[model samples]
Target: MRDFFEVRDVHVMRSGAHGPLPVLGGVDLRVGRGELVCVVGPSGCGKSTLLGVVAGLLRPARGRVLLAGRDVTGTPAHTAYMPQQDLLFAWHTVLDGVALGLRVQRVGRREARARARDVLAEFGLEAFADARPDELSGGMRQRAALARTVLQGRDVVLLDEPFGALDALTRLDAQRWLAATWRAHRWTGLLVTHDVGEAVTLGDRVLRLSGRPAVVAQEVAVDEPRPRTPGVPDERVVRTVLAGLGVVPDERAPDEREPDERAPGLPVRLP
Candidate 1:
């Protein structure tokens, strides 16, 4: 596949009380047009930091971030980001907050809200449109924030654990919604998640990062059909990601993992 986004040898450092701490060490990855790539790594392994770099929230100490062949390193203009938290304003109504992205884009308020309402209706948040963030449930808040992120009209959307805050059941619902929306819109996404299942369910390919001072350790193609059955799609793929994170499944787990079989679609590179 042709590359739509590229992070080449990107490195980052964060200032700590003692000194500068190296976070990402020569990280590199690429995504094709309209593809969703999910990143998984241990907690505090710079997974989010990597997304921040691509989102233009942090300028890499070295290397560059390119989108559609243009260097957008350290620039937030071309991308839309939805962080871990919903980040909806307490004062702004759902309609207002969802329209924020368009507003910043210079779309007229009336027109922005009209567009926002259309998306809210589509996302099943129309009933809560005029309600404040605090009034909505966790899932609703996430949907609202997602609406804002996507309304920006950027081809790429950076998601940092977008469903992390919700409870298990709610998270599953959000995952389904996100998958369907992605299929419909065909937008490019780079999502970071601690949940391997989430990564497996949502990504066309799952990328695993090494420990701190992170880099791409491995990439597994999720060859399963779309809208996968979230948590139980494929144990072997889950095993592969877990292995990268140094995790081993229970010896007596119901399905005894085969010793030599690789995941069904051995290697997948979008074309």
Candidate 2:
């Protein structure tokens, strides 16, 4: 199949207190249908900024963003963006909140609500459909947000640290759920996360960006299968990188160090 998303020679800049700053520098990326690509980099690198550019929320000063071969630069509606926060409204029930996106697009009230309910059910949130956000746990709220994004019916989804705040168990659960959900729906997804484990667990290919004026530094492929198991060799790669970046420790057998942990996403600060 042809690539569902393509970005070429992309460059992005922002004007800050110091003046014009280069965010993304000549970055090239492509994602086939159902591909999940993770971007890892140092803090303050343009990881989130690159996501915004791909989502068409921010136009690159130079380059092109093509969705299924058509340029979508400066077009925001072609993609669904899920930020760090679920952004769930405490006053609205899960059904009502998830339906907001569809309603905004003028899908009739009954139709939108139905679509929302169905999507929420797929994520195992059917029982909580009438529950308010405050009643849901952090992970459930995030799941509700995912359902809302899916209901928006966008071909691409940009996830910005959607599982960052969850505890380890919840994070693992969410990751498994995401892989299953992505497989079933086959939406092209680009996820921005600070967690190396999350990136390796969900991404088909992981892209690393250098800090601001962020250029694609390196690309790592996570060739493992879905339902990633702990203590697996692939999972070790995640810990290796974490240790190398000083986030964790280089506690593995000494010979295991150099090649395995070399990818990227080292914590900005060493332990």
Candidate 3:
């Protein structure tokens, strides 16, 4: 209904053993209430850096992050962050791990556990509530991670390659689950993904980032319907990104030549 997350001319510069480097350069972006936006880019692009800035893990040298008309730059707990790894403790049971967020937020013990159980059930992880993180499959662990985030009940979610570690089939399955979950909950989500298919499948709008000093190269709407079909979504958007990256020739014009099968480290790994 309103602008839930906004990044205006955001910039992140880092200085370590290496010289000063700009990871994000005047990046301008917005995620409206209940909107799902996906970010895709090359390997060295700063998609994750942008997420870190939004999550308040990294401070921007310039610009700001706004949540619900309030500035959250360098502030914690304004939004929930889900990193590439699930980060579930191996020793903790599924419910326990999920409840950790609520507990940290000082939600009452009884109330937090109840809400955690309910959220897990909603995600179809109720059966494994008592199981340890190691006992669950990859998808289930990610589900638990999401459950934890939802329990915090934050308005904006910064998802950093949440499904990167799963197998192809598992990743697809998780994508569907994530799409369904997003539809059901309708939280404003910003996801950073290297996989173009993942971006197309889950995003209402997709943004592509160029190399270092990452800037938005292109933003494409995913016109496909939600609850995406396996290959269909990939086919629709992957070709577009491939063309943008010059891996595939533009089909808009008549060209007898096919896409270069040998674009180094392209998303689909063409045969």
Best by TM-score: 1
Which of 2 and 3 is the better model by TM-score? 3
lDDT of 3 at 223: 85
lDDT leaderboard ranking: 1, 3, 2
Instruction: Please report, in order, the local distance difference test score of every candidate based on alpha carbons.
Output: 0.85, 0.81, 0.81
In model 1, residue pairs whose N, Cα or C atoms come closer than 3 Å (at least 3 residues apart or on different chains), thus clashing, are: 1-270
True-structure RMSD for candidate 3? 5.7
Candidate 3 stretches with Cα past 4 Å from truth are 16-18, 253-271
Best by lDDT: 1
Can you write out model 2's per-residue Cα lDDT over 1-271, one digit (the tens) per residue? 4588888888988888989988877888788888888888789888888888888888889999988789899898889999999998889999999999998898998998888988988999999999999999988999999889877989889999998899988888888788888889878899998888778878887776766777765566687877675223376667645554466777766665444244453312101
Total backbone collisions, model 1: 1
Badly placed stretches (over 4 Å) of model 2 are 230-233, 239-271
- Candidate 1 per-residue lDDT, tens place, 1-271, comes to 7999999889899999999999988888899999999999888989888888888889999999998899999988888999999988899999999999999999999999999999999889999988999999899899889889988899799999999889999999899889878988999999999899889889999987777787777788889887687666577678777765668743433364333223432222222
lDDT of 2 at 159: 97
Per-model TM against the reference: 0.90, 0.86, 0.89
